[model samples]
Target: MTHQLTRRQFGAITTGLGATLLLAACGTSATPTSAQKASAGDKFKKASLTFAFWGNPVRNAYTDQIIKNYEKAHPTITVAQQPGEWATYWTKLSTQVAGGTAPDIIQMDQAYIAEYGGRGALADLSTIESIDTKPLKSTLDEGRLNGKLYGIPTGNNAYAVCVNKTLFEKAGVEVPDDKTWTWDDYLDTAHKLTQGSGGAFRGTNWFGADQELKIWLYQRGEDLYTKDGKLGASVDNLTEFFAFVQKLFTSGDGPTNDGYATDIAAAVEQTLFGTNKVAMCWMWSNQITAYQKANGGDCALLRPPSKAGSADKNGVYYKASMYWSISSRSKAPAQAGGLVNEFLNSTSAAALQLAERGVPANPDVLAVVKPKLSATDQLAVDYMDAIKDEITNVPPVPPKGTSTVGTVAQRHEQDVIFGRATPVAAAKAFKSEVEGLIASA
Candidate 1:
């Protein structure tokens, strides 16, 4: 399994605007009239709208039901629902944007919101009065770029370690209790776990650059980029991180960068942790379902190991998941805004989000849905909840060209591990390149 971003990765880099218009279903109302509301009758004007998102079939089904319910309640508005697999969603959506036929409402990854929103592709939803603007009060406030709210975050996500309990037991290594565990404890256990398993297994596997190391650096009181959009952190932190990974690589404790990439793609049962080759792996919280599918045996989630010798109580920050935005070119801005509000604030929409989306952003939705969540989903919910108060900052919307910077940071480290570049040289080069990207951004 190559753990790389899918074909949609291209969509991250380019913009396009070619897509077919999907009209809302038949007899849908266009807008709500005062008279219609006074009569307690279906008042929404007859209108057609399209919503586009990327997800698996289960998520698609849940979204469909949400749309169906909205249609039933209004009876005069028709919604055309479009779902794409991760591999194709970005490319297709980019094409729609380029062709000037983008969906009225689009589900967007937070990373691209800055680039697209900055380009006038996304409308400022704050201007719409139909939105509750309360449940997402904080979220909406952050999506603002140059003083406009372009996207609304759907919910929060964060990276965590998922350990194979069976592998831990088999290796005679103890899994650290989440609340008390530190980086040393995790690494110490990992060292033993890999050693005891011989060459057949390792301690951890996954992308280490931006996801694992940057977060670690933050916990250590450093950041990758500066407030002025220049390089902020020094090479020392990255060098230290690479040295640790190098030790793991040499000791056969962690897969090499390439090996880790393979595992990412296959996500197969035989790839280390999936096949019981490793004891731990880093994954987004939303991945619990995939992990459960790949490895049928018992597994447990844990916090990322804390930084060494740090007083900062917060080790991990909540990642605002994807954002929902309306195309500035959309003909039905008000209708799209209404849909966004309904999806985020309604009981029925909450149910759909619980089953399909990882967690709803609305606290009210979460309150109603928590009791019904599956064990894995509830784990994500609880983990995010535990860190909610501690989350200090959300990484700002990445600049246009820097979408590649996060991935490139990983490659630079890979080059160091492969002995293609010395750590200092790699760090210096990375700093210069990232600073240049931001400067041009």
Candidate 2:
């Protein structure tokens, strides 16, 4: 659910992509030369590389320490850190790539990986071997587009419902068995939590994000995009997706319109769930740490309610919370690969990150880090393990030209929720507009 750069903004970059060996798997590629393949992971060459990522101050400190430690390990290479906020990071990146001053190591996201890769801006990660990815297995597919690997997964995160045990306890309500919960159960619980507290705070937060919609679609054997990069969801599916979230507002079980905008944009510590204003919230697993820190209590993750009231039908899937990719423009591919290796596979680095980035994608690393993680982080890891069987396939790497999917989806869903548009009307407009966006891309 992280957006890289918008396609319109990338038009300038991709239009200049030449006969590329770095793009073999993403969008377009020509065969790499024997020399290029041979040099991919060559012995740590002496190179000063730049690494860029988006994060707040805490994550920045971790990256800074990781960089210092990496320099200590490989004295021959030096790294410069380029950190920015989410919006600013992508803006600066596009400018850098266009100017031929792109960083060597870049933290990537699923939403825009393909757009950047298709334009030949990322190295073919599959061509490199020194940076081992075997520990993560299939979760890496979230970074694969077209036919080749352009990005390496940093960790795995899943979208699910997080309930506050403290709120339930204060309301004198027993926590429902997530295993057998249905939509009715979810709605009922939200209502009871609200009523039990006499509206001191709302019951739940209503969100219509792509993650929330995908859970609903997956449970019904539907999906948003096909492997072929076309829309796989029907208008009817879109209608129901909007309709369901609309129930929260109509039933008076969710926050006010004024509060919805404010809460959704606030930090974890200031939001409803973070403030203990809601009994449950649908969110990415990576947020558990922040939510836990904010609430100062237990934040339990549960599988999203299913149609059949069974965990088997919950349709949860693991997504690489974020990723690492070597810039095609990098002069130090090996050194960049080494840095990514340190972040993803090094046990010491895993300890530094803990679950701040979600559960480590590598089981070997998780096995090492788990015992040392805080209780809330352990909760996240255990939740993922407990529901492994309920998970289906990893989501497809969003294809190039779909950068606006998340934004467009949220707008349409919000219209339905706020009663500004009917579900069916919003769905029709959403389908037409999204199709047009992809076509234009």
Candidate 3:
């Protein structure tokens, strides 16, 4: 389906991002022409900075509150928010980056950070004293490319099984212990739940997403991309993973029925689990609050079932959900760094931020935010704490040439599921296609 940018989105890009992205391309620390020049050692100067990000209405609301707090604190700086949906955000940012018009402050993701950072589009964040590095010691490296810090993690997130408590109680199945559940056990329980629910709802909705692929790889003590940025899993591994995805869709006794394909593209609020049509599904723990707001906090988080039935050895890891990055070509690099500091350490931002961007990375931010959290938000935070010892370090960024890996993963997954190719053939072709991308890059 074709999607059109809303009036607000169009206005956001044309009115501000165009100019700012051009500034990013210029690679100059030229101050904004209209702002008052500041004294040498001042923390901030009077300036207008543009911050770009991807989000829906809910996240936009949170950001609006955060930005308001920042402006109130630093009365001279004004910020224009450039928000876009996930589907279009990267594409637009790429055009802006290539043409030298990237935003002053940008929301960076694991996939594209390397692409932009390696190409000198993102500022080296290590030189900025405004951004505190101590709090993010655990995850700081994930945002680095070749030892230069280009971004800072906004928060942490984990992929897990999300249970609909209301649906589970009605289906008469006991919740499985996340610590001990195995993939085999998960399938059996899903079958029982699906049978118990009759035709009104299914046990879960199977989704073929990159997040799932990563979790599956991690469970086997392997990774999707090696530290060197090459494809890590072999064709046999890909075949096994693809076959598992097909089983999830074809097995009506468990995770899916007829709606798996359609459901894959739906928003969080529209998913079967969110609409209370399923007992369980895999999702990022940070999304708990969004789904909870949609269906009430009648949901719970569990570690994804492990191959060996133990959470600790499952190779479960915490990923820095997203990041704050500055443009190498930004007009006001220092002020932009200060704004990034406020974004990461502000008490007001902490109070307003929940797991929407994942749990706060700073201990101080998490402490301040936890008391103010809604029940669902607390669950996300608590889940991370509950599994701290089991959590591994963040995965390596997918290298510069693999930003399109998500698209490649989704396409091959669909081909296998829809019978256009056998799992083995698809895996072979997928390995070839992905390796070729790395080689050409």
Candidate 4:
């Protein structure tokens, strides 16, 4: 079986991250352009800054290479890289912030942007002179909160269904037309595949994810959060979503709770799709590379299901995969801002990093990197381009303490699946719990 970089594996690579802090001892604070020159006297000549991010080993390697190139270009600045897995990265960062030793630059996710920005932990990127905001004006605005730009969008990604063509062929189920397929078509296809596989396979492994709920809500002219930053989904929306998912589970068209637990607990390489036990699964477009590599099979990307013949098929949208932000407490804000500029706009860095961070947010960089991408990555880029005109406005930034909502949804979803709670009861409880979380925040 091919090895896939699962989230657990990514987070487990925590070695050597502490040594990055040692580089700070060797250099004096050098004057950086924009604000540092005006704030700090030119007494110190060298500046040492730490750029922290989380990713798989491949991302870490590319980031290290990019840092080397940046250092070679600016001899006065030395950048130490702090790499961690997603789960541990936040915990370590939170601890560092409490201790007054946060890294200068951070790789931020949209889910936590509001939480951190609201607490005044993120620096305003609008003041940075080196970062040109024109190319990705609309995308960059997704990172704004309270009339300030808190993060810079690194790249865009859309959710899609990744189909294992080999499995479809083996099961003799015709693939649905992604462009026109509705939720009813999706369920029918899934049922056909499950029955055709003689109980050896499932149709999909994505029923448990909250993203599906968001898409369903959007198709009904609602969203996960309202424009005013309140919980926007109604109980009817939640009940319908859970009921549909419950049918998929009980019908054996999707994974059972035990099967799901087993698959989800394993590495990505050992997932149902990777093992050819499922014909289709939902994933971010950016994950195609890893999923295909792990599965080692012919795969294709398709749009998610929408309501049939709905005049307003405004359900799908491109989301910022992640963002780059500067810490509010950094002593070398100018240097941090310059590094963010280099990461986003520098051709040399873009050439080296390519689409490892997802499609480049800079159109100039995208133009250069397009030809160099692998076939799978190019397909993801093309998918984003294809859907550019169809997607609706970006959803509201999640409110503070919004991260816990996923856990709550998962727990209640399992209750519905296990028949411990009716969909109506679970929906009411979920809404109350989430509203309380927001209230406490």
Candidate 5:
């Protein structure tokens, strides 16, 4: 009988696999120096590997096709596919790592690169001579930890404001020029959008995300994490950040706490922006396709607003959408690295995956795939290319244990918005909590 597995069921199954394998996801460990380094002329022996990734079913299908093509080219190697939703993928992978049965090749995220790479859970990609780093030289630095490359960027993305053009026109609002727009201008436009919609819609739905704070910090010549792995932005900067968000919530320019909660819980197809209840929202450039598909309207991408008088608008940077890394414990490291090289540089693989993962990091592959992208994807590509020269260097890879900062920021911001705490109090609490996390790590 054919059976479909629910997310919970899939997690349950993977949990058993993890226990048997003894894998731990993110934890403290001394770096291991035992992995065999691959030479340029090393030949991959015929082997089997388990490749794991987190994505929707559509992405799984695309990945399956790409794997099929890779197998056709190299018939001696076999890859077993393990796909799961993002919410549980890391947990399962961690368990597998601890059990020593981790997938051969892992789909990694920037948020946990420091955690995994620092702990020696990932193989150092610098030893893999088959993969070419020249095309994406500018982006390769993001996957580094202590000057060692652990992950290869699968694609590149950037944060931006996604607008429902149809909603903006219907509300009689002129789209602000992204080049000259400031944070104050963004607020005014949002307020105007709310008033024009006669309270039926909001101007934006993204006042609480930590990404906004990251951009704000960069604009002020600070960052979420310093190069030395400390909290870079001062407490006062965090206070201002929370205060601005609180103002947006109180001014009716954005969703209320309860409203925002409801919006977040809804499916993508039913989100406020998807339903045309918000004219704009902040999102990764790579997410434009799904947002536009859900909104069923003409969606436009705009750069995030800069500080009004600051001559240097350094808020923009290319972010690694995700990365491909091989587990250090993989029995077939050579074959696994070969697959990653193909995934990154093969023309056939790029043709099929296109920007589904994000814009191809390889310049040559990007050129080949640009014309094949959908309209919304083309917009993302053009947006990234246009801003490439203006953005600052990529921010430091998030420090170990720093992933919890996002949750802390969200909780404190919600508290301030709901009047449970003043912005200053929340900011102080956030600073203390984040420092504690970093110290504990």
Candidate 6:
């Protein structure tokens, strides 16, 4: 299928078109321009700054509230906010970055940060003295590489299964006791849930072949790549992961390639549990709010199924839900730093960040917003609480070209699932493709 930018997406890009134009106005000189220098100085009474990000209603509401609160606190500064839907947000931002007209404060994705940061597009956040990261010590630590902090995690997320309990009960498949469930148990239950015409809305849905395979690799304490750009796990491991999904597909416990390709609407579409074809599926915990609002049904978070006999079962880790970072190229680094600090630390800001994005990164933010959470949001909070001990903010950063590799890995698995390649062939092709990307980078 061809991917074309939607009209809504085009409108969003147009809304932020001026921000990109401003990049040309601010030339690519090695040193700051006079206006840039003046921005650093107090030459103007009012300063205009643009902050760009991608989000849905919840994130927009939260961020808009934070901007209002910040404006109230700093009467002289006006923040020009630009937001687009997630599908096209990165493309717009990348265009602006290439043109040297990116926003002063950009909501950064963990995958792209290293690439942009390494290329001098992102600001060396460590040089900014105003941001007191001491309060966010743990979260900040994940953003660092080679002794420099590049991005601050806005919040952390984890991989988990979201189960439609009502469906499980209706299907007569016992909900596996949360603490004792293993991978085989989950798969068996998923198979039992599979029944009726068009698969009867039981079992799980693998929207993308890579999703379940990644979880499988995680369970086995292996990953797509090593820290130093070498192949980490064997082709056999990846092939085994693919074979498991192939079995699930054969058993009607998951979607077939045609099913996902023809029907699935990406993450947003999958969150609507009452579409009722999927009984249990993988998701990030932070998505509960959107899921609740979009589908408005009974669903609960569960620990991802573990590999029954795998040695390292504690593979689940605290993953980041993007981040906020100052551009190394920004003229007003202090102000940008101050803005990020305000967003993460202020009570009202915390209230704005709640649910729309994920759990607040700042303990203070969570405390202030705790009483204001909805029932669904509170459930997410409870899950976070239960898994808090297992959650460690490890450096989730991959090398500069990891996204390219990830894209290849995903496509390779998709092809394998569609019967375009054998599992072993897919594994070898993915490795070769990704290794070439890493080499080029």
Q: Candidate 1's residue-wise lDDT over 173-249, tens digit each? A: 88877666776777777888887777667888756656675576776677665443455567788677766666666
lDDT score for candidate 4 against the true structure: 0.75
In the range 407-439, model 4's lDDT, one tens digit per residue, is: 567778888888899989998998898888678
Tens digits of per-residue lDDT, candidate 5, 1-441, equal 001233353345344533433333344232333235554444356889899998887789989999988888778888999998877787787777766777989998887787677766777887766567777787888899888898888998888899998888888999998888888988999999998998778899963555778889988878988877888878889999989988889888888678786775566778888888899987788878888999898998888888853323848778888899888877677778888888888888888888877788788898889999889999999989888878774788888767656657778988898899998999899988888877866
The local lDDT score (0 to 100) that residue 211 gets in candidate 5 is: 70
Give residue 404's error in model 2 in angstroms.
3.1
State the displacement of the C-alpha of residue 329, model 4, in Å, after optimal TM-score superposition.
1.9
Name the better of 2 and 4 by TM-score.
2
Q: Better model by lDDT, 1 or 6?
A: 1
> Residues 177-252, candidate 3, lDDT per residue (tens digit)?
9899987888888877888888767777766556677778877767888888888878887898888877766777
Error of 5 at 409 (Å): 1.1
Best by lDDT: 5
Q: Tens digits of per-residue lDDT for model 2 on 184-284?
A: 89889988888888767677886565777677877778877778887777889888877877787777778877677777667788988888888788887
**CA lDDT of each prediction against the hidden true structure:** 0.68, 0.76, 0.75, 0.75, 0.79, 0.65
| 1-441 per-residue lDDT for model 6 (tens digits) | 112334454344433433443553576532233223323234224566789988878678778888877888788777889988768776677667655677888987776666666555666566666566777776776677555677887777766788877787778777776656776787787888875323567588664433345556666667655555455557788777667656676676777667655544465655325367777766677766666565555788887666763323535556567888766556666677667778777777776566455567678788987788888778777787777776432434666555544445556766777788888887777767766756655
| Cα lDDT for residue 244, candidate 2 | 79
Poorest 10 consecutive residues of model 5 by lDDT?
1-10
Residue 378's lDDT in candidate 5: 96
The residue pairs in collision within model 6 are 122-328, 123-327, 123-328
Instruction: Please identify which of the two predictions, 3 or 6, would achieve the higher lDDT against the true structure.
Output: 3
Off-target runs (Cα >4 Å) in candidate 2 are 1-41
